[model samples]
Target: MHNFEEATSAFAKASDAISLKVNFPRTKHSAMGLKPYLTKTVWVLSVISLLTDIASEMLYPVMPLYLKSIGFSVVLIGILEGVAEAVAGLSKGYFGKFSDHSGRRAPFIRLGYSLSALSKPMMAMMVYPLWIFFARTIDRLGKGIRTGARDALLSDEATHATKGRVFGFHRSMDTAGAAIGPLLALWYLYAHPGAYRPLFLLAFIPGVLAILLSLSLKDRQPKPSGKRQLPALFSFLHYWKDSPPAYRKLLTGLLLFTLCNSSDVFLLLKVKQAGLTDTAMIGIYIFYNLVYALAAYPLGILADRLGVRKVFTGGLLIFAVVYAGMTVDGGGAWYGLLFFLYGLYAAATEGISKAWISNITDKADTATAIGTYTGFQSICTMLASSLAGWIWYRQGANTVFAVTTAGVMGVWIYFLVVLIPEQQKSPGQGG
Candidate 1:
């Protein structure tokens, strides 16, 4: 086996060549423009994510069902998910900052993938649901650490003009894995009949594959600058003060947008309210993921071609409309349409937003910028999810949907008025 240093250097040289070839001027883009973006690095990272998501999702859908089978209460399961997500969200920023301070993205990527990969066999060893809880938290902790740093590396590798398209393609690949995972689980259960432990053990293969692939990723280091290092990681005060104006503005817009949005569980609850069978609900959920996977690259291309601003604005508007549609007793067909639209909204926002962030920040701070933005968005989204749940319980679904729609609409207008113009003037697109 090659030494790690040699493997890293080889990966970096190959990535650099691919980036240059594919990320040529958007004006010179061809019908085969995607050929360039089909870089070895991006594809490798996407495959890693694809494998990781497959491993995670195979277990994810079955987790609650498995817990209930093992006599764990719904309350405990809910607590586990809540706590795990909170830990992941809180840790993202710190890890991103670490990647920046250390000037290496690959090490953090390796460590994160290793933690999550270790989580699989741990789940297989579970005799109690509590053990599963620890396993799940460990997996989520890996997600928190790797996500920002991974995106930063992606941003670094992508050209400024094609950032949206590149991120969009990655999202497409990730969603493809999400779509495949459940089917694999379902097939496994059908073939082996109640062999949950075997299925859990099988998850380890993909997780390990993900980790091994991640080990070969190139780490981009910050150029030699003699800026004073912070005395302590917790002493982020100076860093925050020194953040670019563009990053701050972008963060404000993101916080406002995310504050209006909440967890997808609320959408699922609406499906339940509509009296859909559990099987039908699963079908719809899978269909939604498929739509998300299929639409991401095309929409990302549209973002690159027409401007991410235009596409993002349309997405926000659609979000408001979808939530508003849910406020009423729309038939099952309408609900299906809303879910499809939700997928489109995801395609519109997820990658484009990251590309947008890359556009606004200095390239050196890519990891820190992505981490801070993601960490802030995760915290606010947590609050938004809780608030939506509370309002739905206290009032009604309509009341909850109405409030969310109003908030989304408000943000849409705010974006049109303040953010979009800046984006048009910014480097991501034309003046």
Candidate 2:
């Protein structure tokens, strides 16, 4: 019995040592600085996003104008945006769970991007608002399919220590594409007036490239353990019940914060409200993208060092201040500042939130947790947008801003009392 016990202990130690050797230096430690930046998986996925967003954003910035030109009412536009976003959010959780169950990520990603690519030319050919609605819905569906799967793949490939950097780099690349997409659209619009169709068709080229790039991605299947074999479609409410109270508290705080975050359309509307021309509004959006692209990675690195919860809380506070400023200031330059600050907020929270959720959940359920978090946030965003729209139509812009300000204050109080203590107890819970 002693001999058997000794042998078992020896084998366990040997297995651990082997794993350490194989996975050690998981992130390269090259002298070239940038060479050690991200795992090959993250780089490939980032490139895919870069191409995909370039295609998607080509139409996105001017989508409202396109809808208006086609005679869609503002109410319809709001409904379309809200529904599309809600669908995307809702799908992420289910599709993510599906991927987890099937033990495949790459195929889902391919399907998603392919669907999005197909939507581009269809959008160009739309003769009616309904066609635009279908195109946008399909496009957002594609986004939903890939978002969780791709993030799960990123998590699978990156070392825990470098997860923040990998996610941040991916976001930076994604936002860079966003910045470039609008510029390309602007150039196309300039060179050929009333050639939106041609630009939309042109966007399909990058979408094809994104799909092709996705083909090269390798799927990382989770191990076939007993824990993983259980029913995959678990309720997030039940899942949270077993989680540390800190995680639940953090999520509650996040829900509060997002309720005020609302949609970017409101920001564009605010720009117009501040007296910017349509063209200048697009230009301001371009400016926002540029700032978002530049700041995403650095802010991610900062989050890694200073902690995600702190960075996220600070981001919420910044957003409150920006909304307050937008309320009081009507100058065109103030619009620019608002957009720029909004970009900063995006840089701070987008990737960091995903990283935080991953930290809170088990590895097997990472995708599910991501989906749940996003879904919760999206539901809040939908409600906020609805309220904002009502405020705009009835009370006015001041009411909208005031309501947003109140929402942010609610977020502040929730986090200070609940999330902060939870985070303190689990210092390194989420990466």
Clashing residue pairs in all predictions, respectively, total 1, 1
Worst 10 residues of 1 by lDDT: 422-431
* Residue-pair clash count for candidate 1: 1
lDDT of the candidates, in the order given: 0.77, 0.75
lDDT tens readout by residue for model 2, 297-372:
7676566556777777787777888888777757778788888898888888788777776666556666666767
Once fitted onto the true fold, the runs of candidate 1 whose alpha carbons sit more than 4 angstroms away are: 1-35, 128-130, 192-194, 220-238, 420-431
Q: What are the runs in model 2 whose C-alpha is more than 4 Å off?
A: 1-37, 70-75, 126-132, 222-244, 419-431
What global local distance difference test value does model 2 have? Answer: 0.75
Q: Which pairs of residues have clashing backbones in candidate 1?
A: 22-36
TM-score of each: 0.86, 0.83
